[model samples]
Target: MQALKHFRIDFVITAAVLVVAFLYDSWAGVGLTAILIVVEIVFSFDNAAVNAKYLDRLNHFWQTMFLTVGVIVAVFGMRLVFPFVIVCLSGSISPWSALNLALEKGDPHTPGTYGYILTEAHPAIAAFGGMFLLLLFLDFMFDEDREISWLTWIEKPLKKLGKLDVLSVIIAGIFLLVASETLVHETHVHTAVQMRSIVLFSGLLGIILYLAVSGLSTMMEEREAAKDHEFEEADAHSSTGQKVLLAGKAAFSMFIFLEVLDATFSFDGVIGAFAITPDPIIIMLGLGVGAMYVRSMTIFLVRNGTLAEYRFLENGAHWAIGALAVMLVISIRYDLGEFVIGGVGIAFILAAWASSILANKRDAVAEGATDSTEQGANV
Candidate 1:
């Protein structure tokens, strides 16, 4: 019952959307809307865990922004305007024309339809999102400061390799070149030369964007750490204004990072939604509701300290992210269904949860045995 309180708003929004959907297309509309909501939630479950990890570091004001302003951006900006922008760019049309085409809800199989244009744009989308997410995963895997190891065999070697500076960037560059040369040939939307150019340019942009945002975040974090150290050394607290300024800077960078991460996660969900239904409104209602729930879940996890409770949960989410990054790149050439993508992440989360339980039990038993031996010695 206590847990349900966090999701109360999500439920209300879901009901409202369902009512609108039913009014629009009767029972059929209601059914499709339900399916989409589930799809979005299942696909983004690990995303909430990942978001919570960063969200935990933010101040209260920024955390509220994530739920309020962030929700508006995710629901409308990404779900509606972002797709229109993509169509306009890919189809060489105006925003109005893109909206008109979307309203027409033409068959995706038909070449000139909005859906067709979006589908054709998949290669570049995959390249950009794949590279961004790949770097994220690589950085996590290679972090020398990471104290915990979920997969010892894999993470141990990667942590050792982290001593070599910029290794992740070099590896990502190799992947981009390989993907450009090999995967570009699989697409029929553009000529090999054009496809190669698009993939290389988009992938590079993704890499550059990741580096820029992450660099800013690291700088802000270091500054904040320095300020804390200074205050501690002086045995004094900083003024409220100075603290707020530093917190604001750190929060702003993290907010940008979170939004970009959301966009990368959304690429597949938005594209995959068309496979289920062509109606833009329906897709928005379904995904919008799901996005709200994901945000709520992040807050719940942060407030409840779920990540701290389940020690391996964050590790599992990152592992799942690494898998998704690989899949996004492979999806440039092959159409792996949404189920395959979402299922892989869910599997990792479940496995990690179970492992955490076992670890707790083992530790408890070990402590019990030690206590018994100590008591006997004392006696």
Candidate 2:
């Protein structure tokens, strides 16, 4: 009951959204909307888990901003408006015409269908999103302070190599080059020397965007942490004020990362939604509803301290990100069933959870043994 109290508003709003969705369309429309919601939630579970780590660091104001302002970007900016923008860019159509294409319900049979436009445009999307996600994975995996390792043999060495700030960029660039050259869709007819130029350039753009935001934010945060404050109790309040300012800066930076991260996660769900139906309104309703739930779930994780308890859950989510990154690049040239994409993530999640339980049990046994040995020595 206590737990449910905190989420009463989320529950009410979610229920209201579903009710409105049902009322907005025919039975088939309602059914499609529900499916879209479920699909988004499943695909977005890792995204929620990853988001909670950053959101937890923020103060209340930033947290509120994430829920209110950030949700709009997730729901409308990415889920609704972004795809049309992608079509316009990829298909060279006007914004209005691109929107109409999205609304027309894509025809799989026609070679020049909206579905075809979106599908054809995927290489660029994959290049951009893949690099962003790969960098995200590398950053986490290479953290020197990270103690637990899901894949120690590989992760341990990566952590050591993290001494160089640019290693992740180097590795990611290599990946971009190899994937660009080898995995390109056969339809592209660029001169042999320039085959992967566009894709590679798009990936470079992803890296620059990531570094621009993440680097600036990190610099501000480190500067704040290095400031000297009076150790006397008389100055404690002033020191606390400075800490708040630092937190605010960091939170602002995190807000940017969170929005970009959410946008990357949406690429799969948005593209996949077209597979089910091309009705833009349905895509909006379904993905928007799911985004709401993910927000609620993120809050729930923070309030409950779920990540602190799970131990290896964040690691699993990072691994999932890595897997998804590779899969996106592969999906550019080949067809990957939606089930396969979703299933790979789900498997990692389950494995991490079970491992957490075992780790807890081992710690319990070790503690019990220590206590028993001390008692015997005292006796």
Candidate 3:
């Protein structure tokens, strides 16, 4: 009963999604929706941990905002509207036209079919999302203070290279250019030159989006730090109002981060859904349900402090993200199936879990040895 209260909205949303799933009145439709949802939520286990890092830092009011308001954004903004926007920009259609095109869907090869349009726009989608995710992985790799190394041989060298300024951007650009060229040669597109232009511009937009969001957060953190310094000298403790105010600021920034991160994670799910079915409503319902559960999982991890207990869990998620990034770029030319994508993500996460267990056991053993050594010396 108590647990139900926490997941009440998620329950409602899930019911709504299943109803939407069944709206088409076809077994194939319903099944595809279910499959996409499972794919999204399973592959996004890492996303939950990532969101918890930021979501847990905020106050109850802000957390509630994420639970409520964030869902609307995830469902409507990313799942429904975002794809439309993608097709609109790439296909050169108005919003109304895009909606009509999506609704009046035909065969996959048929012009203006939702699947066709979305598939056509894959290069741009892949470029934008790949750049965003690549930056994310690069930043994590370059993080000097990161202690754990899932791939130490590669990570150690990257960490060293991370010392160079804007190296991530440079590497991402090279990949983007290479990927766009690959798409020109490999993918069935309208034109090589046009695809290159769209991809290059979209990839740049993605890089800008990531830098802008992260820069804003860094700026806010700096201001918050300065405020804390003043508080330290001015008073023994801050007032409730001041604390709430700080929390609000932090939450606002985190809210932005959460939304963008959610979008980045959804990139693969969005494209991968088309492989199952291209009906926008079906994709939205299925992926939206998955998004709801992912958000719920994020909140669960935050409240349960799951990341604290499983230290390397977050590292595994990020590594999975890096792999996903690579897959997105590679998929531009190659038809890397959803099975491959989801399988790789799960493998990284499980490997991380196993590594965490070993680390904890080793830590316990070391602590025991140290305690015995001290006791023997005392005796």
Candidate 4:
């Protein structure tokens, strides 16, 4: 009963979203959104599990931010807008027309449109993916305690700044400004510019809201902790309220961060899909739906302790992230099919899961043998 109550909001919201989607079902709009949701869900299975570890730590306010603000940005920013950004950067087609062509013809770079003007796999896109991959590779190699020579001068200072809530806001705002300006500049058509601005602004808004909520949640947790001076335990403290708030913030932060990751992952899929079909609406529907399902699956994985039970899963996901990052960089220079990236990621995760299951069985068998030996000796 208690668990059901706790999940009531999520259930209701999901239902509501589905209902709206159903009611609005045009062959192009709502119907497409539904299918896309499934696709996003499948692609994001590992992502949700990774996010769950963090979600379980956030507070109520932060949790709300995850569902509301986080979803808005992720669904729009990456799933809907990213394809057009690719088109703009390619320089042959207007963003709006590119999107339209994608929807109508089911291809972003069809034979007739300006999409024909430039080659597939623009250089800039690859650079973006490469930069992201480089970060992941370095993070994996160095671990948290490792230091980078290039960042030595600023690393400590940045670490300190990260601890400051206010600084996060400033940093997010700056990033938003840059992304927005870049999107606007890349877009050739007036309508495309407007649409790009809206999408970019929404993303910026999400980042700002996330930082603000996280800061407030942190403050509340600190205040509550101070109130319970003697409260200490190895597993959990007596500050239930504080824990909830903290958990919510952590969950929200994780959700937002994961959404960013999903966006990064989707770059190749969304852009490459344009080659098959140009309609922005269809592309958006397919990708958006897929993204949502992945988010849900991630939450389910976290709640179920899937990753903890299968340590190899984390390694698989991180590896996928690294690979996708590299793929993005390659996308900038040459054409690699979206199917290849998605397929590689799925295969890696499946293999990791299998390995973990086998390892668990082996460990269980060993433990049983030890227990039997101990019992025989005692008898």
Candidate 5:
């Protein structure tokens, strides 16, 4: 009952969206919308786990902003408006034309259709999102401060390599160069040179954006830590309002980082949603509901201290993110169906959960043995 309360808002929102979907197109609309909601949730389950790590740092106020303002950005902003922007930019058409194209609901098979235009833009989208996610995985793998190692062999060496400055950047740059040259050949939409240029430039932008957000977030966190240290050293009791203000300021960069991270995660889902149905309205309704549930899950995990309880859960999520990054890049050349993409992440998460349970049992048995041995010695 307590756990169910966390999802009360999600339940209400999902019911309302489903009703709207049903009214819009009868049974067919409801069916497609249901599929989309499932699709979005499956594809982004790992995302919820990753989100909880950062969302937990935020105070109640900013967390509310994540649900409210963030939902608008996730739903309409990414699902509806972002696609229009992509169509306009990729098709070299005006916003009004793009709007018309979307409303027309033309066949995806036909060129110049909105779906076709978005599909045409997939390479650039994949490249940009892939690079950003790749860097995220690289940074996590290489972090020396990470005390827990899910895959000891891989993580330990990576942590040592992290001591080298800009190592993640160097590796990511090489990946972009190789992917741009090789993957661009797979698509003949533009000449090889043109396609390569698009992939390279877009991938570079992803890397730059990641660097900027991460650097700013680090700076803010360090500054906040320094202030806290001074307060502690001086034994000063800060006012509640002042502490709240400081927390909000410190969390601002994290908020921005989470938004960008969400955007990258959405790129694949938005594009893949077309494969299910090309109606932007239905897409928004379904994916929007799924996004809300993900937010609810994030907050639930934070409130329950799920990350601490299941120690390997976060590690599993990062592994899934790494796999997703590779898959996005590979998808530039081949269409690995949504099933494969979603399944890999799910598998990692389940495995991590199982491992955590086993570790707990082992500790319990060891502690029992020690206690029995001490009793025997006393006897």
Candidate 6:
């Protein structure tokens, strides 16, 4: 009963969101979205485990920021912005025109059916996928923390660069800008001028989001401090509140960071999804819902301690991340469709998770047998 009460809010929120989505659409779109949610949730099991390690360090206000702002961006921002940038770089239309199209029709998936829409999809998409894939490969191969990761040498030297908070935000902005512009020119889809403007605008968006999260965090801290001073000595509180506040903030930042990570993962995912259906609405619906489920599941894992108990869960998630990164890179250079990406990525995690479960069972059985033998010998 007590546990239920603690999680009642979470349950209610989830239920409400589902109800609303269901009410909004009942046919192909909603069904597709549901499937996406499930797929995303399953594939992202490891992500949640990894996320908890950071979320456990944040404060509450940030936690709230994570659930709200983080969710919105994860569901809409990336899904919408990425494809638009692709359009802009292709020079199919101006940035303003692309935005108008998406708003008027809600994310056109294919160039042909986009109402004779001026689109720059062709080579830019290929280039975007390629760059995304390259990044994925480097991340998977060089990421230095997967139970003895590959790039510890660089991590320490990089740590000396100072204020990772600021640096990470800057890097994210730069990536968005470069990704938008580079894809446009390399794909030969758009003019340099158009691509440049798109990159600049997208970079600005990144900067604004970073500032919003950070500024909100600072304000929250100030408010918390004032609250602390108001209490008398006998009625004083322990630092648990402060700790939770910190954990929430860290969690929020980590949540956004993970979303960026998720976006990187989605580069291939979205590309592959198009193979299934060219409808932008369906694609967004599917991928958006999937991201949502993954995000929720991540929160569940942190709260449940499943990862900590399993021990091998983190390894599995990192392995999944690494694999997805590689897969994205490969897709960039080749045409490894959705089935391959989804199948291979999900299979790796499932195999790893199943292996961990079996190992745990074996260990438990061995311990039980040993204890029984000891009891008999003592007897």
TM-score of each: 0.95, 0.91, 0.89, 0.62, 0.95, 0.60
Q: Which residue runs does candidate 6 get wrong by more than 4 Å?
A: 1-26, 42-46, 59-64, 99-253, 373-379
What is the lDDT, from 0 to 100, of the residue 309 in candidate 4?
Answer: 84
Of the two candidates 4 and 6, the one with more favorable TM-score, higher being better, is: 4
Q: Model 5, range 1-379, lDDT digits (tens) per residue?
A: 9988878888888888989999998999999999999899888989999998888888888888888899889999988989999999999999999999998888776899999999889989999999999999999998999999998888899999999869999999999999987777644358778888999999999999999999998899888878777665565455333342336567899889999999899999998999999888898899999988887788888879888888899999999999999899999889998889989999999898888888889989999999999999999
Candidate 3 TM-score over all chains jointly: 0.89
lDDT of 6 by residue, 147-243 (tens): 5322346533444553343554455455555555443342244456765564455445434543565456546556655664556233434544434
Model 5 misplacement above 4 A: 186-189, 233-246, 377-379
Q: Name model 3 segments beyond 4 Å from true.
A: 1-8, 23-29, 186-189, 232-246, 377-379
Lowest summed lDDT over 10 consecutive residues: which window, candidate 2?
225-234
lDDT of each residue in 1-379, candidate 1, tens digit only? 9788878888888999999999998989999999999999988989999999899988888888999999999999888878788899999999889989999999987898988899888888989998999899899889999988888888999999999879999999999999888777745567889888998999999999999999998898788777777665565444334343236687799899999998888998998999998888888888988998899899899889898888888889998888888898888888999999999999998888888788889989999999999999999
lDDT winner among the candidates? 5
Model 3 alpha-carbon miss at residue 355, Å: 0.5
Q: What is the lDDT of residue 16 in candidate 5?
A: 89
Give lDDT: candidate 1, residue 120.
Answer: 88
Any idea what lDDT model 5 has?
0.88
lDDT score, residue 263, model 6? Answer: 63
lDDT of 6 at 353: 68
- TM-score of the candidate numbered 5? 0.95
Q: How high a TM-score does candidate 6 get?
A: 0.60
Instruction: List lDDT for all candidates, in order.
Output: 0.88, 0.81, 0.80, 0.54, 0.88, 0.53
Query: How well is each residue in 1-379 modelled by candidate 3, as lDDT tens digits?
Result: 7557767887887766677667774677678778878878887887887788777777777787887899889989999988888888767878888888888755657766767878887877777888898898889889877787777888888888878869988999898888777665434546677767888898999999999998888788677767668665676455434442336465588688878988888887887787777678788888888898888888888777777777878888888888888888787767798889878888888898888889899999999999999999999
lDDT of 1 at 294: 90
Whole-model lDDT, model 3: 0.80
